[model samples]
Target: MIPYQKALAALACAAGLLTGNTAAAAPDAYPQQPVRLIVPYAPGGGTDSMARALARKLSEIWRQKVIVENRPGASESIAASAVARAPADGYTLLFASDSTFQLNPLLYNHLSYDPDKDLVPITRFAASPFALFVNADTPVKTFQDFLSYARQHKGKTFYGSYGVSNSTNLGLSWLSKQFDLDMVHIPFAGQGPAMIALLGGEIQILFGNIIPSSIGFIDQGKVRVLVVSGEQRLPNAPDVPTFRELGHDNLDTGYTLGLAAPAGVDPAIQRQIAEAVKQAVADPELIKYAAETLSIRLFAEPSGQYRDFIADSRRILQQRIEAAGIGKLDQ
Candidate 1:
């Protein structure tokens, strides 16, 4: 007869294969081992900033290492699906964006895992408004100029996005419908490539986050921001008008980022992690990094309200998708 330990190992392997729940530490003790915090994008972006901050604080508080793993692709759905399939033991968490949880559902035809059923929100961390940027040499200087150029040039113009059906893409789609613009969408593998295309003048404009690359280009006078996608102008860029201030409320959209564990995580564990995140985002260094460097506003809505926020965002995204006639991508 096989030894008891060998038999248990065989059973665990079978369970993993059957349910797609990879091996995980038992939940009774909550994280008795190292925890993985998965980010859907590469390093040096806003998501990485928030994930690293929470990982550091969670590690210190829990006395267990919280590793930040980058799994960038599919507009962050790759990492979200992986986390959704992980064992519900609070050891594997997704540092997900609104694109991962809200937009992907309406964008993709068939997802590997049900986001609502597979992942549970822990805590919301931030909301990042996008900037409407154009090349410095472009004749347009302000949002009004952009509108006039689009109306005059129509289909001759092109815009770039990190991916189709992403937050930026959806926001641009809403803008096109509202303003009757005939611009074309040019997609890139990621934000870095999109930024490169923008600099090369392959695309006329890009609606993207105010990250290091965008900020560097803006400071270098290579590209300029015409508007921001928040209710009010950003403190750093007070001259740039918001969509709301410009009387285009539908274009006033920003993406949200947060941490989530696979559904069925113990309520107590979820609350424990949420409480920890609440403390982490409050760190002076983290707050400074989010605001001064990344230009992202930090958010800390309670878990229940966070879920409501997700639902509301999803509803709005669905309406935009339908109104714009954006088709789902084949998986």
Candidate 2:
């Protein structure tokens, strides 16, 4: 036997050299193909708009096609689960809201994937403030007026939300409990449907995110905003009071959107995606569109900080759900 020790050492050296070559080749020429961004909602929604903006910016920067795929159903869980089961090669990404990551896990008894474990938070992209609105024809002109009317009407008063187990629904639930008011919850397929129902007089009140589509109706005197559920008043809707200002600090809710990848993605790949998203969100055109058209506050936090924020949000939402006695939907 020609020196067994030397033979083993030679094998080790060869393996090390091959591993180095693979790493170098992979990282240097990453994203040699187009990337797919999965949005877990129907097209024409706020999430779809945000995803399209991100794709446009990233495609420009990377010089590679960034395609957006809408997989709407199950209140965004279907899309999230798809991304979770995708390859960890950084080719697939998920653009989702807090409901998919933080609230869904608590609201549903069983989920195909655990967001905290299966998804890696890349960055927070944007946030839209949730607001309380009533029909312009309704007698309620202010938050005080709505509350007083709600108390007197009790169960007769109603509020519509995007869907059951959504952030808006939970926010309204918590508010109703805190105020000792009997407000009926009307769940719709989405914000658009809920807004239509409100406009058609199917529902009296709506708690929703302030989007251009909804705000247009408000501007046309079809809906009247009572109070926004943000820490402070929105820049566009400065005249509307905040939940804090209305003496309902506990009702403050934020519906934020962010980018995430499946967990166990290579650290280098994670960094690359995060950098791309940071650049995308910071694009001047995107900023202008988000500020002027979407009326969304552009808040971006890097991967690590966003992960921490998600954890904190999950905890807070869990507490609120339990306190409100909200039951999970059967999966």
Candidate 3:
């Protein structure tokens, strides 16, 4: 194992995986008025869906409307900054992809809100592990096969991501180096175009989300999923092995859909919100929605575990970016 991989192995046990009975009732010390859940992405993507779902549940529990406010733009800095500047009250919370707390801070130098200083993690409600993909038309049928093929093809094999220095690029670049695959990287304007390129065979490889995108295609047989990230197999594809199960260590991270608040919120209030989330996550309706509609893994850990996960992820991602030889986006 490499240096980062060995380090990550130690975190395997400490990494956040919240599982238990529904939490007891919260103190309800906060949220007398309507609460605003700010989402950094537009109102249609997975993060937005997750925000809306959790907001609805929270609304029902708190009896105060939990409105999902979309402030999508600037690679999520817009919403992040807005929440960071908001009063350190329980009413204003950020529900966004963990990248806002992880990748963005490392990649963008001009970011307005310092995540480490301004934001406190509330809970990580859901996550979607990445699955390795290849077009069915490709001759390679497995990861090892693809590795051999890529080694033979060298410059001919291609991998693509939606943006530079983004999670997709970062992971793919790291994978390329770890395996010495020598595959070329291409950046698409967005995931939609990137998926289109993959389906059209313009690109041979892409890391796909387990839900709606990759899982949907797996049935249609348009793409072959060689492996998945995370510590275990996906609910949608139980037969597929995780990176660790396949003897590839340190590739356990996933796209986390979570909640955070401006730093300095009362720790008691944070615990209240986290308890509400834990109960909401255990809801049968949400369990169904996440598993069937969204295909997400639920981890309803409270503030402390959420904080630790973000810190560990940030440190590991920094090591990954450095290992991949990627520099800051502005530079």
Better of 2 and 3 by TM-score: 2
* Model 2: how far residue 253 lies from native, Å: 0.9
Superposed on all Cα atoms, the candidates' RMSDs to the truth, in angstroms, are 5.6, 4.4, 14.1
State the lDDT at 253 in candidate 2.
Answer: 81
TM-score of each: 0.85, 0.87, 0.77
Q: Give the TM-score (vs. native) of candidate 3.
A: 0.77
Q: Candidate 3 clashing pairs?
A: none
**Tens-digit per-residue lDDT, 32-58, candidate 2:** 899999987666656577779879888
- Candidate 3: tens digits of C-alpha lDDT, residues 245-317: 8788765555777788999888878888888999999999898878766657786777677778888988988
Q: Which pairs clash inside model 2?
A: none
Ranking by TM-score: 2, 1, 3
Error of 3 at 207 (Å): 2.0
Q: What is the C-alpha local distance difference test score of each model?
A: 0.81, 0.81, 0.77
Write model 1 residue lDDT over 83-180, tens digit each, in one string.
99898888999987887779888889988768889899888878888889898878989999998988898987788876675787888877887789
> Model 3: how large is the Cα RMSD against the reference?
14.1
Off by over 4 Å in 2: 1-24
